[model samples]
Target: MLRTVSVLVDARDRAEALVRGHEERLEAVAGQSRRRPRPRVYTEEWDEPLITGMRWMSVLVRIACSDDVFPEPARQPAAKYRIVTPEAVLACRPEVILAS
Candidate 1:
């Protein structure tokens, strides 16, 4: 029917407009600087207890578990355990602390 066709056409026009808006936003973001801001240097000395506390340990654990920090192996079983290294933990410290 003509009415049904008109409704479908209107729906498509709205969808196309939404897609265009998304594409424009993506392009604008892509045009900006791609460089990551430098991590802040810590001037104040951290207390030994605070650094070794449960809260700090939890933050390190969360960062270690992130996919960016350690990419998951392809076709690996979900139940398989991956051992996190001390080096990896040290490397991601700045990112975790600065939240960059």
Candidate 2:
């Protein structure tokens, strides 16, 4: 998630203007890169992911899924870890809203 955020902040261009403005440069870099330094980003949702230089990301699931993962009450869990159910996640609605 952090990596996604970093990409959103650094790599993604909001306006078509940048692409339009760099039409010549875009053509120049059709496949090849100039090997230039990009923006430095430090994001943390789980970990970070890189665009050009490097990236880091965490692979994890949350909450609990299946009695096997969490086990029922006193029962010993058979699985090593549990995964978060999408429904549990979706249960919480966003508290904030944004307007233009």
Candidate 3:
């Protein structure tokens, strides 16, 4: 099954230019970077009187993309959701914030 899926995915890549489209563009923009540093990022759900952040799979997305994603020591594989104090965020000093 794994071999079959790999073959199918490879065929799809040849037939479909849109496969990994965004990744291709981002790579182009990245320009064969050698010493380029990944930007630190923070993803949050809201910012009312309190601040909270995404954990586990959500945070994993940024890490996979090679971004210096923040809110370390996530309560992952345990609490899918968690809190992020302003102090902690400030300490991370993220270059980008994805608040949604």
Greater TM-score among 1 and 2 belongs to: 1
TM-scores for every candidate against the unseen true structure: 0.33, 0.15, 0.46
Highest lDDT: which candidate? 3
lDDT of 1 at 45: 14
Model 2 segments more than 4 A misplaced: 1-14, 30-52, 55-100
lDDT of each: 0.38, 0.27, 0.56
Give, for candidate 2, the lowest lDDT window spanning 10 residues: 58-67
* Candidate rank order under lDDT: 3, 1, 2
Better of 1 and 3 by lDDT: 3
RMSD after Cα superposition, model 2: 19.1
**Residues 1-91 of candidate 2: C-alpha lDDT, one tens digit per residue:** 4445646678554344455666655445632432433222221221122111111111011111111121121122322222234343234
Flag clash pairs in model 1.
Answer: none
Q: In what order do the candidates fall by TM-score, top score first? A: 3, 1, 2
**Model 1 C-alpha lDDT versus the unseen true structure:** 0.38
lDDT for each residue of candidate 1 in 4-91, tens digit (9 for 90 to 100): 5657777766666677797686556544423434332211112321122133333333333322233232123331333334464466
CA RMSD, predictions in order: 12.8, 19.1, 5.8
